[model samples]
Target: MEELSPTAERLVSEFVRTTRRQGAVPSRQVADRTLELLRQLVSEPGWRQTAQLVGQLRAAGRQLAAELPTQPAVGTLVCRLLKMAREEHGAHDEVHEARPHGAPPSQVDSLHRRLTAGRGAAPAADLSSELTGLRANLLAGLDELQTELDASADNIAREALSHIHADDVVLTAGRSATVLAFLRRAARERAFHVLVVEGAPFGGGHRAAAELAALPRRVHVTVIAESALFAMMARVNKVILGVHTVLADGGLRAPVGTQALALAARFHSVPVIVCAPSYKLSPQFHRGDQQEGFLESVSPESVLPYADGALVGRARLTCPLFDYVPPELVTLFVTHTGGTSPWYVYRLLNEYYDQQDHEIVQV
Candidate 1:
């Protein structure tokens, strides 16, 4: 495998840093960036065989997955790239190996000329031609992946009308673009009340409430504190929340207060619906002890910035960026394709990731 150019290295580093600092970028954006990075990776200076390219892609994928183990999209995109390469290689083999996967050299080497002029002057034309076709097809496949990422939000939002009813109260937490888009889509045809839970410390819910209120629709928007979750449950017809990751065990890693919200909804028998892109569906099982490692922790100052330094220094505050919401608490998952039960997530995972790549970290 050839080394990546300086520009590609910088792009990868920037993505890693930005993702760590700002944990709320949409999963679709992350997937798109990952796909673009892979495209650049394959374009590096290398005129290798299809098998060699596939091996390099796998190695690069392992490195990228290590950079951000919690983001499942990185691994999913990598697997898709590998599948494309293998398919192209299979097609080339059927053509009697007459063409190589790499671009053919402008000048073909003759045996007598090769023996006299040395091997460095030219490359085999067949190998070069094959690579040209492989790169083009791989890029086209990447473009298709990007298109899917761009369309996911709208596709998922289209199903809002089917799940939401007129004059119902929809409660949600955090400033999730996915949830906001879903609600706004439904608002176009029906009027309802939306209660945004103030996810304290971050207060993302306040921002979400403000955005929802500003939408040009008759949907009533209300912002409430986390403490008021249970009290307001009776009034909420449904809980439509967004997630950071959906583990294969049918559990969700969501906003810090989402567990409480889901619990309240469960107690009241109100349906709890989760809105997320299919890319966020991870192939790993959720481990409680390891959840903290996967999730980001904000500064303690966000919760007690005004407190005395001495008191703040002496106390340990656990402010995790996300919380676990078990499958049982969730009634349904509304993804880009359509709505389904949480147990059905494994099937989606199978479609997106390879069986061997299920534990990407191990790879």
Candidate 2:
């Protein structure tokens, strides 16, 4: 794959983090909110967020499918919810009078025109320039979130280590919750030495490992087998993981091995923690109580050169890029907002929506 631009990568990473926090399920309110943020990144206003939201929506549909409930409740419920959100937040008829009912980029120019119609717009005032400056300010505010994430990362790491004695090790899943927070605090505390599990096909954990490595603090990376997780428990004192979704009830859907590791950690008296950004924490759950599966596949054609015997009867291979880790296995959720128990995710969602809904105003 071609390398992604830093900005684009950051956007995707943030999305990934958001999805983990929101849980695998997609809800209309959460989707609508996410769409708005993505819109800010593109020129088409809602168009970009619409496209970006599609991935999570599809994932939601798939999760709903997994429950296989004959009742069809998932479709009916979510559709109703989505329709309600659209009616409320989707799009509104513009007030042609233009005192500013809305000023999405698609309509900003028209609004600007209305403000200056037949009036020679101020020669020195550039509407686009003004918009650009405003957008910059908005982006700067969002960028400040990085500092919170940094702090959360270190805090989680420290908390994870709190129950741990020196020389004891910890292993975490692919970006389990609050890894960013732990790293942030870890860097600030001048922490050195971190071992990360490289999640394959994507190896997102490597991103954290790389960031940690760059912190002027010593950090290390080691790839381990999914099968060996339990066996290695003795050396690991804590397990830190990132999450994609945290349900209203506090259940989580993360990478596959996560649940197993959480169980193992509990068995071994190890604390399992999550690091996450605040944008994540939406109270949505996958359709049906069931978790979603990762769509993965291995190339059958790649082994063609080896012949049928070497190919071991010529079976195709498949791989999963993600997994659904349950919330009960987690001990704490480290977020920019603060450390929360799994159940607190619902409360976090309520608070986030309360703030987000009022954040954008016509004025």
Candidate 3:
């Protein structure tokens, strides 16, 4: 994986290898799983084992777009290419006033004119070939993305947890596993209580609270509304949440109330913590230095009332769906490998992408 294009392939392969060893996935299914995982993995800076594909976008200009989208660097590359095209065209047009008397356009400028001209605006054959290559690379990379994602998740969950003393309130939402982790350690000494929230709409918090409730008597379950969660923040000592996206500026995109929750906790002097697998750590981010998040929604009918004809009625509906919590609000991220802050995530991306720099060439 010495080239930009190969980054996708290498990532898929590495994820497959890791997952297969963990028994999290089968060998036969690894290929297909990795494909879907890489596409998503490259879009965030959460669980990446390598660097942030910073220069991988150059592949598009190198005529590798045909196979670049699915590659680890394709997402970044496509974004870069789009911006590059705009920039290059902007400069070209700015300097494109009628040629000075007797002055001929530069060779490159002449080619540009030819490309823009109707008679030779573009080469259909070349374009067709490039498109085909792009599709091939995309599909190839998608094939391994999923497997990598799941496997990476499982592997990250396997890391041993250090003990956090009792008389502590761990505030967390989403990822039932990480919460269980904190509770498990608490159960060892039987002294900690847990304050959980319902990640409404999807409400992963409901699931989390339930799981913790059944974990013995020491873990207390506090199911609070999105609004009330902030008001009750002073009671907790630690805040742990999940990451939806790791933005470019070393921030995180978590559930909506998470930022509010984190902020409230911060006011009370709480040491917030996040537990996740290392694979969830990625190097891909955009829009300034901050991480971005996409709030997934469910069927609209979910909000419909169950009262007579109410569910099917157009009169009333209730669904706020999901929200993104910025990383600045996060205190520490706990991965199976270890716990670290968002700033450390940047270095992880650098390392991962560095390994993938040359090896990530498009197929």
TM-score list, all predictions: 0.81, 0.50, 0.52
Return the top candidate by TM-score. Answer: 1
Q: Candidate 2 residues 274-314, lDDT tens each? A: 76545444344544433332343345444253466666564
**Residue 249 in candidate 1, Cα distance off native in Å:** 2.1
Q: What's the distance in Å from true for residue 354, model 3?
A: 3.7
308, model 3: CA deviation in Å? 10
What is the model-wide C-alpha lDDT for candidate 3? 0.49
The local distance difference test score of each candidate is 0.75, 0.48, 0.49
Tens-place lDDT digits, model 3, residues 37-137: 43543453331222123233333223332322222233333342223222333233435466465554444444664578776434311111111133234
For 1-363, candidate 1 gives per-residue lDDT tens digits of: 433346556666776787778775667778877877888777765545765566566666666677777676887677777766755664565443554457342122123344766555433223222545788888888898788878888998999999889999999887888898999999999999999888887788889888888888768999888888899999999989888888787888776788888889989999988887867777777776565334667677778774678888778887776777889999999888898798888778655664555655321
For model 3, the superposed segments whose C-alpha errors exceed 4 Å read: 1-32, 35-163, 216-218, 286-296, 300-322, 355-363
TM-score-better candidate, 1 vs 3: 1
Q: Please give the lDDT score at residue 129 for candidate 1.
A: 29
